[model samples]
Target: MIDHLRDMGLGVDPVCRVLDLSPSTYFARKTRPKSARRLRDEELIPLVTAMWEDSGRTYGARRITRALVRSGRQVARCTVERLMRELGIEGVIRGQRRRTTIPEPAAPRPPGLVNRRFSAERPNQLWLADLTYIRTWTGRVYVAFVLDAYSRRIVG
Candidate 1:
């Protein structure tokens, strides 16, 4: 409403009076000065944005602030955080682990392979086998192997 009145060339005092507000309050708000901190934030926002993009948008506020300081540009960590929030920039979040093991009922159980007797008289007398899971860039992979108790050689 104040802007509309000003558009018609009317002074703020008259506008405030018509709007049932004190002219002093309206004038004080209209002539209010911005603090140095606010001005610095406004100025630093672009710098922070540039640094964030330059880092391939992978760095969070803490790292971006450190990079800025290292580059001779002084700024606060909190300031970087605020700027990142305003620019809608965020760090990547890692996902949780997924279970990949699946037991088979008819996988053919090789009798008490070790028979609780881990010792072997000769090289490949007793063998033990086990299965485990591993994660790779492609996906989860299962690995099974057999080892000889005596010579400790991987039979399979």
Candidate 2:
């Protein structure tokens, strides 16, 4: 990355300063040998990509790690997750999410007395009442409101 920046006309010292790194440290790291972990990651990148593709691109990190273990390869789930993130691959989530607001079948229900009619011939002839709740820092606050149908204004 530093080399790329340098090629783009940015000086090494300024770039290192912006990255909170010393030029000497950057130079030392640039010449340092690849660590074991980095080498292992390089070797595993292709295997992870192949596994992901073989699964029709529907296996997440946990499943990929399990598959690798089953195949006699020792690898951590976190490592597989990181590799998958770098590869820009992910599993597809299937099925519909469960609804949390299902109405009770046994509960008594109110009759539709207004027959879905909201308009009124005159003010005060018909009023609509609704209950709603809001979440706040303190807690949930419940609010009830009454609306004049003819005027279409909040009465309470």
Candidate 3:
């Protein structure tokens, strides 16, 4: 990475200083042989990458690990998870649903005492709730109102 930055017209000494890496240590480490685990990871990276792309980037660590295991490759889910994090690839999930009128069958039922009659002779007898959206330069803002049935004015 430091070499790449240097190639991009950045000075190596400043880059190394910013990364808190000593120049001698960096070069020495680069010359050292990779560990067995690192060698295995290097071999698996390409396979994991291909599989992730094949799945349209929808495969998370667990799914990727399963695919590798099914192909007779021995690897742990956690290692795959770490690799995915390092590579900055992730599976997308559906966000919270926006439906407001969904019914729940298992929820306790309330009696229909009003029968949809919104009229009221007294101020506090009935109330109506409504939601409206106001558009502004930035975005739409939702406003909710509680109206008194008798006076047709906002109650609460």
Candidate 4:
């Protein structure tokens, strides 16, 4: 920026004053060498992107860093994270959610039992029910379970 401004015949002092910069700071920056770390990061960005694509765009920063290191590159996870942010590329974050057992719109909900309190003083005093699904070689299976609160065992 200072170089461009000075190229237009704007003297250092005038440019500094206009941009609210100190002359000493400007001269220091002008004389300072580029950081080796920054240069390395610039070079690492392309390599990182390639690895990300190689992993089908599903490798997050930690995995990318691991792949880079395994390929004989020394890079920090945080550095890869920052570069990924700059490139606007990211890995897909996957999590499991129940997809089956959609409730009917007119289905009635039972009144609260134990008032949402799971613990019970007796084995049959409270029961908890939950529905979930499992995947097998044949197909998907839906399951419903009833548990005794006090005994913490399957009641049904």
- List the candidates' TM-scores in order: 0.47, 0.56, 0.49, 0.52
TM-score winner among the candidates? 2
Which pairs of residues have clashing backbones in candidate 4? Answer: none
Q: Candidate 4 on 1-156: residue-level lDDT in tens?
A: 888888998889998999899999999998898899878878998999999999999999999999999999988999999999989999988766556657888999988867878898987888889888788767778888999999999989
- Residues 1-156 of candidate 3: C-alpha lDDT, one tens digit per residue: 987998999987788899998888878887999999899889988988998999999988889999999999989999898888878898766455345457889999988777889899888889888897776667668889999999999976
Candidate 2 Cα misplacement greater than 4 A, ranges = 98-156
Q: In what order do the candidates fall by lDDT, top score first?
A: 2, 4, 3, 1
Report the error of model 2 at residue 54, Å: 0.8
Residue range with the least summed lDDT across 10 consecutive positions in model 1: 92-101
Task: Residues 1-156, candidate 2: write the lDDT tens digits.
Answer: 999999999999999999999999999998999999999999999988888899998988988899999989999999998988888888878655544358999999999989999999989999999988776667667899999999999999
In the range 1-156, model 1's lDDT, one tens digit per residue, is 797889999988788887899988877877899889879888888788887788787889888889889989888898888888888997655666676656799798767745688888998777888788788888778999899989887889
Error of 4 at 68 (Å): 0.6
Q: Which scores greater on lDDT, model 1 or model 3?
A: 3
Quick one: how many clashes does candidate 4 have? Answer: 0
Candidate-wise lDDT, in order: 0.83, 0.90, 0.86, 0.90
